[model samples]
Target: MLEDDPFHAELVGSWLRAAGHTCTVTESGEAFIRQLGRESFDLLILDWVIPDIAGDEVLARVRTMLSDMPPVMFVTSRDSEVEIAMILRAGGDDYMVKPARKLELLARVEALGRRRSAGENDIIEAEPYRIDTAARTLFMHGEPVVLTNTEFELARYLFRNVGRMLSRGHLLESIWGRSANVNTRTVDTYLSRLRKKLSLGPETGWRLSAIYQHGYRLEHMGIRSREGAAAAE
Candidate 1:
């Protein structure tokens, strides 16, 4: 948790601990980022207003820096509807304007768990595809489809974030790690492989579309990819 206020930090931390979860409190975004780099967390809760780095910046950095980032919740005093929309659009899973009610806060936290499960479930489903994280295997229509390790990882990440726009940098960082010498086109290449091997065309009830100027989005329905090879351009 990244909260500058002492009373609120202690209050929320104590509440989380009482609810049978471990809590680590950080007073600054720098400390928060340092801790995140050092340890894996189930959820990330932060305030919009921080002493040094703004909460939104922290979130952007997390997206670019962390490979397997967890769900994020904004617990702050910013109550404007626009701010709420901005946070959600920026990939925050939940938002609660502080001073937070104990019951409501805990309820929101648990609700995030339901939405994401924080990767707790070793097996994840995206319609016809079932990915077994423990075994690094993928099954399409209950039949095994062989994929390279990196391909399986990319497929799992794409399936996990279905309906969300993911930038190429986000994909590269998540799949290839930050220090890897992979080019951005490498992402498109791997995505093309997944498309052909898994039949990710419009016929499959899932469409992995490449958005112009943006990156990719694997949507279950309601959107279609543009025609032509320019889809990857």
Candidate 2:
């Protein structure tokens, strides 16, 4: 964690350790970056109001340096919806207002861990489509289908637990990484994009669908590509 405040560092670090995670607390963004240069960490817990490099700037830098970057959570005092969205768009995994509850902090931390684990490294193969959780990449018929970061995130999440009905709110929180000030339509927009690119038609029986007011699901129909393509046209 990169937090200049001693009290905040101690509190969050302790919680993470209690959850069986190794926590390293740093006092400045510069120090955090320097430490990052020398080592690899599974996750970064950052303070937006830090000395030497703001949280958002630090996140961009980290992205450039780290391949397969680990998840990041912004622990800040700013609570506005706009602020939350800005941080998330800038590549933060999640955001929390200052003085968060221990339970809330732990839960967010755990969620990030789950997302990291569920990412590209955890590839799930259900025929023509294959998902790599750690790599956050999806392959259709052995060809990679390019996805934006958010799009890949949503796809991997659905692919990880195939056939499970995910609620919109749950998806919004998990895939976007924050609940404050986010438009639910954002989820629909991303899903629409995913459907257009990833859908294999009815032959493959692999489709992303909206369940009435619920969220979305990937249903396998046991159809292959050629047949599905013909059916689609």
Candidate 3:
């Protein structure tokens, strides 16, 4: 948690610890960034204003450096609609006004943790592609494929809803959190990255299709039959 106010930081940190989460509190954005470099966190609770670097700028730097972005919640006194929108657009997953209620804060944090944990507990299989949710790992044809955290989550989500058309808004909310106000173009950019990284195409026995006036879908190319026949020999 990156917070300048000692009272709020202690309060939030205590609450998180009571709820069985390991909590780290940083009073400055610079310290937060340094800690982030050495540790991987599931969630980031940030204050809009900090002693050094502002929260939004810190978030931007983090997004630039990390491929598997952690869920970020801004806890700040800046409650203006414009400020909130700007923070969300910059990739903050959630926002809370200052003097936040303990219960609500705990609830949001738990929800983010649960969502991330859920993604890690199940395996999604699409023939050659094997995704281990718990391990956050992917394999293609028994060979491991390295995916950044966000990429792994996106690929798993697509595989989970295979053949289903998911709207851009739905994906943004689902993956980035309901509070995220990111543009649809962000989804397009990530989809392109996923496609190239995973080699999603006709020859790969999988197709990630874009629907006109709709969204996207990952379709299996029914190559299992060929594999089955070849195995029979």
| Cα lDDT, all candidates | 0.84, 0.79, 0.82
RMSD of each: 10.4, 16.1, 14.6
In terms of lDDT, the poorest run of 10 residues in model 1 is 221-230
Q: Write the residue-wise lDDT of candidate 2 on 189-211 in tens digits.
A: 88898888887457556778787
Regions of candidate 1 where Cα sits further than 4 Å from its true position: 118-233
Give the higher-lDDT candidate: 1 or 2: 1
CA lDDT, candidate 1, residue 163 = 63
Task: Candidate 3: list runs displaced more than 4 Å.
Answer: 118-233
Q: Residue by residue across 1-233, what tens digits does model 1's lDDT show?
A: 99999999999999998886667899999999877655446689989999899999999998887666778999999999999999999999899998899999999888887877554678888767888998999999999999998999899888776666687877887789767899999999999999999998655667888888678888775334423323555
Alpha carbon lDDT of residue 204, candidate 3?
67
- The Cα error of candidate 1 at residue 59, in Å, is 0.7
Error of 3 at 67 (Å): 1.1
Q: How close is every model to the real structure, measured as TM-score?
A: 0.54, 0.53, 0.55
